[model samples]
Target: MRKERKMDVDDEQVQVMDLEAQQKKTSESDLPKIQKKAKHPVILKFKDVVYKVKFPSQRKKFFKQTTSSPVRERVILNSISGVVYPGEMLAMLGPSGSGKTTLLTALGGRLGGNLKGSITYDGKPFSNQMKRNTGFVTQDDVLHAHLTVTETLVYTALLRLPNTFTKEQKIGVAEEVIIQMGLTRCKNSIIGGPLLRGVSGGERKRVSIAQEMLIDPSLLFLDEPTSGLDSTTAQRIVSVLWELAQGGRTVVMTIHQPSSRLFYMFHKVLLLSEGNSLYFGSGSHVMDYFESVGYVPSVPMNPADFLLDLANGVSPDESEDIVTVKEKLIVAYKNNIANELKADLREEENEEADHRKEANTEIEKWPTTWWQQYTVLLKRGLRERKHESFNILKIAQVLIVAFIVGLLWWQSKITHLQDQVGLLYFSTGFWGFFPLFDAIFAFPPERMVLAKERSSGMYRLSSYFFARMVSDLPVELILPTVYVIITYFMGGLKRNAASFLYYLFSLLLSIMVSQGLGLALGALVMDLKAATTLGSVLMLTFLLAGGFYVQNIPAFIKWIKYLSILNYNFKLLLGSQFKPGDTYPCDGDTKVCLVEDFPSVRSVGIRGQFVSAIVLVIMFVGYRLIAYFALTRIGVTRKSRTTKSWLLCLD
Candidate 1:
C-alpha cells in the first residue's frame, strides 16, 4: 500500500508539471505573433565605419594612447554593414552606451560626426532617392514651440515636401498624422519639452513620430522613444510604432525598460551588452532562449527586464542561472553571427576621398538648394527672436541708455581734450558695442533653437547667419539712432547739421560692426554659460584694449588696438567732428595730428577713422566665418562623427 501511494504521488507530480507546460504552450499560442518576414533586415550600410571621437571621458585616454586629442578615433564598424527593408520594424535595443544613438545618427546622414561606413540608403550611399525618403528623430524633440503643431508641420512640409505636394496635399498629410498619433484633440498643441508647457509627455512623443512620418521616410530611426514615461503610456507609444510599421516603413528605435505590453510590439529585438551585440533576433525567442538556458521569469517581470538582468549578471539565488543564461545568449549570438571585434575608424579618410570624387556630382537631387535652406532657416530664426519679450525690453533699454549717455556727455562747446577723448571712447565702444552685446545675449536662446534645427535639415547655416544680420538691422538702429538724435540736439561737437548727420551715420556704421561680432559669438560657443562668459571677456578686452580706458598698451601690443572694434568706430566718427581749420602740432607723438593740438577737438586723431572702419569690417567677416565653422562642427558633434562628440554620449 505504501509503495502504491509513493508511485501515485510521483505520478501526480509528473501530471502537474505536464499540465503547467501545456498551459504555457496554449498561452503562447494566444499571444500575437510575428514571422521572420515581418522583421526588417539591413539593406545598405556605411562601408568603412570610423569615429573621429569617443565620449569625453574616453578622449583623454584616447589622446594618452594616441598622442593626438580629437584625432584619436575608433573604427566602430569596418565596412560595417546594416540594412532596412520596407514593411518591417527593426528595433536596435541595446544597453546604455552601446552606440545606438550613434548608429541612428549615422544613418540619418545629416549633421553626424565623421563616419566611414558606407550607409546604403537605397542601393548606394547617400543616394538622392533614399535621402529624399528618410527621416531621423533624435532623442530630443526638435520643434518650434511658438508655432502650433499644425503650423510647424505645415512649415516643414513647405520646406521639405516635394513640389508635387500642394497646400491641400500638405494639409492632408499633416491631418492624417495628427489623427494617427491621437493628437486630433490637441492638433494645434505645442510639442513642448523642458521649460515649456504644452501637450503631455505621451502626446509630445507621438508628435515627434508624426513629424518624421510626415515626410514619408522609407526608414525611420528613433533614439529612446519610450524614455521617461509610465508603462501604459509606453505601451501606447510602442503600439503606434507597431502600427506605423504596418504601413511599410522600416522603423528602428532604442527602447529602454519596456513593460510586457510594450515588449511584444517589437517585430525583432537586437540585444546589446557593453557595446557587444548579444542577440539579434525575435523577442519571444529572447525569453524562450533564456528559459531554455535555465532562467525563468518570475510571476510578472517583463521579458525586456529579464533579458537585461541576464546580460547584467543578476543571479536569482545562490543556485540561480542568470550568469549562465546571459553567457549562453552572448555565446550563442557570437557563435551564430560571429561579429566580435574592435571597429576600425576610417571615416575621415573616406570622406576626403568621397568629397574629391563627388565634387563634380552637382549637389544630389534635392528639392531645395543650399540658398533656399538658408532663407527658410533664416526666416524661422527671425520669427523665433522677433517674438521674444527680451527684444521689446531691449528697445526700452536702448532709449534709456541713449538718454543717460546723452545727459552725461551733454554736447559742450567747452571742449576739454579729455572730453573729446571720452566722447570718442564712449560712442565708439559703449554706445556702439554695448548694444551689440545686448542684442547678441538676447538672441542666444534663439541660437540654441537654431543649432538644433540647423543640425537637422530644417534650414541652412548661412541663412541663419545672414538672416540674423538682416533682422538685427532694426534692433541695431534703435540705440544708435536714439543716441544720434539726442546727441545731435545736445550740440556736443557740432560743425553743422550735416556734420551731425555724418557723425550719426558713422555711429550707425560702428554699431553694425559690433552687431556682426556679437552674432558670430552667439554661434561659436556650445554652452550658453561658456558663451556668455567668453562674450564678457571679449567685450572687456575690446574696450580696455581699444585705447578707451587706458592710453595704450606697450608698443608690442599696440597691434591689439588695431583689432579693437572701438578703435575703428572712434576714428571714422571722430573724423567727421574735425572742423576745416584743424591742424595739430604733435608733441612728437606723431608727425602730424588733426586733434592733438586743435582747439575744437583737441585729442582724437581723424585719420584713425579710415583705418578703423577697414579693420572692423574685415574682422567682422572673419568672426562670422568662425561662427559658421563652429556651428557646422557642432552639428557633426551631435551626429557623433567627431571624436569630440563622444562627450555627449549619454548612458
Candidate 2:
C-alpha cells in the first residue's frame, strides 16, 4: 500500500511540472512581437517652458469700478524643462497646486496662450503630424455613457484609425484592444453615468485607455489615469502601461498618491513643487539620491509619499525650513540630473538626425473624409441621444402644457380679440421656452467629450455640428407636432385644412428656431447652470417684446421686437387663424369687422405669414451659425489691452 501511494504522488508531481511548462509556452507565444525601431522613434524634449495668464483685478468690478486693466499675472509654469525618451514609462508626481497637469497639457500642445519655450519631437520642432501621432487621455473619461463598451471603442476606431484600414481591420483593432485591456467580459455592457447603473469605475477607466490605444500612437500622454480608482485596480492599470512601454511606445502620465507597488512600475519619475521641478531621475534611484543628499525616510513609507514630501519642502525630521529645503533639492537636481539629461539629448540628436528627416518629411491628413465624418458622427449622435430625445418626460411636458392650454381656451372665438391674442401669445411662449431649454442641455454636457476628440483631430467642427443638428431635428420635431396636433383642433382655431397646415408648419419652424437659440446659448456659456439662467432671462425678455402684452412701443426700442422669436411666431399663429377678409360676429362698435381690417400686418405688408415663416428659417440658420462659431472658438485667448475673467467667460 505504501509503495502504491508513493507512485501516485510521483505521477501527480510530474503532471504539475507538465502543466507549468505548457503555461510558460502559452505566455511566451502571447508576447507582443519585437519589431525594429522606425526611422523616427519619438523623443520629446521641452526646455524653458513658461506659461503665464493675466486676470482681472478684484477691485475693478464690472458693476462698480469699471476699469479694464488686469492687475495680476499668474505664472502657471515657470521655466520647466524635461526629456522623455521612447520605450519609457515616465510618471509625474506632485501635490495639489504643483503644475503637473499644466505641464502635461503644455507638452501635449493642447494649451492656448503665448507659450515661450522650445518643444521638439525627434530632434526637430513639433509639428501637427507629431500631434496626430500622439494620444492624450484626459482625467475625465469623456465617453458616451449609454454606449456599450464595444460600441464606444468601435466608433472611436472608425474616427481615429487611418482610412487605409478596412472596416474589418478597424473592428479587429477594437476587439484586440478589448482583449488586451481585459474588458472582454463586459464589452457588451453600457458605460453608465451618474444616475445609471452600468460598468464599474475600473472598467470605465480601462475603456478610456482602450479608445486611445486604437490608433497605436507613438507617444501617449495621460492625466491622472488611476484617479478615483482602488489600489488594486490602479496597479492593474499601471501594469498594462508597463507592458505598453515594453512594446516600445513612450508613455507619460501624471499620477497622484500612487501606491508603492505602482510607483516601482515607472521607469522614470518627474517631481514638481509649485511649478518647479525638484527632481527628475530614474524611479528606482530616487530614494537613494535623496538619501545621499541627507534626506532619508525614518520609517517604512511609500516612495511616492516620500518624494511628494521632499518636493513640498518637507524634511524627514520636520526641523528644516521649507524654502531652504526646496532650494537645496533644486540645486542638487541641477547639479546631478540636469547635465545627464542634456548629454543624453545631445547624443540622441547626433545619432537620429537622418531618421528625423525620413520620419517627418510629409504631414499626415485626417484618415476619414469630411463626408465620412459627418455620416459616422450623425449616426453616433442619433444613437447617443436616443434616450434624451424622445423620452417620456419631455413628451409628457409638451403634452400636458398643450392639454392645459387647450382646455383653458376651449373653442376660443375670434369675436373675443383679447382671448385670441392670449392663446397666440401663450402658444408661442410655451413652444419657444420648452425647445430652448431642451437644447440648452445638449452642448454643455458633451463639450468635454467634443473638446477631447477635437484635440485628437478626429473630425472637423463643421462636420460634428452639422451632424448633431441634423440628427436632433427628426426626434425633436415629434413632441412639437404632437403638441400642435392636440392643441390646434381642441382650441377650435383654424378649422380649415389649409389654415391648420399653415399653423402646424409655423409651429414646427418656431420650435426649431428656439432649439437653435438654446444650442447657441449652451455653447456660449459652456456651463449648464450659467446657460440655463441666461436662457431663462432671454426667454422672459422675448416674451415681453412678443407684441401681445404691450403694443405701441416707442420707436427707439421697437427694433428690439425683431430680435424676439416670440414676436414672429405669434404673428404667424395669429395670421393663420384670422384669414384675409374673414368676418367675425358683430359685438364691437364696428359691426361685421373683417380680420384683414384689423390694424396690423394683415393690411400693411407681407401677407399670409409667408414672410414670417421665411424669417423664422433665417433665424434658425443664424443661431446655428453662432453655435458653430462658439464651439470652434473654445480655448481661444484674446489679448486686448483689457482684463479677462478667471472664470471661463466667453470673449
Task: Give each model a TM-score.
Answer: 0.77, 0.87
What would the per-residue lDDT of candidate 1 be over residues 1-651, giving only the tens digit for each residue?
445535544654564466445434532342222222322232433443444454333344543565544434443422333444566666776567656665666666653555564555433456445555666766766677766677666667656766677757877878776765667777777655477788888777777777877777667778788888887677666666665666666888777667655666666776665445566556545655555455665543557776677657664442656566556666776555434321321236666566556644543454656676566655665665565524667667766767786677776543344565566567676664575565456445665456555544555666656776676666567656776777656547765777777788777776766766666667665456776677778777777776555563688877776667776676677667664456544555445554644532332356555666677678767876766676665443334444445643444
How does residue 93 of candidate 2 score in lDDT?
94
Once fitted onto the true fold, the runs of candidate 2 whose alpha carbons sit more than 4 angstroms away are: 1-40, 56-71, 347-362, 413-418, 588-590, 596-608, 635-651
Q: Give the true-structure RMSD of model 1.
A: 8.6
Clashes of 1: 30
Writing each residue's lDDT as its tens digit, candidate 2 over 456-535 gives 88888888988999988976687778888888887878788988887888888898999999999998998999999999
Local distance difference test, each candidate: 0.61, 0.78
Model 2: lowest-lDDT 10 consecutive positions: 642-651
**Model 2 local distance difference test score:** 0.78
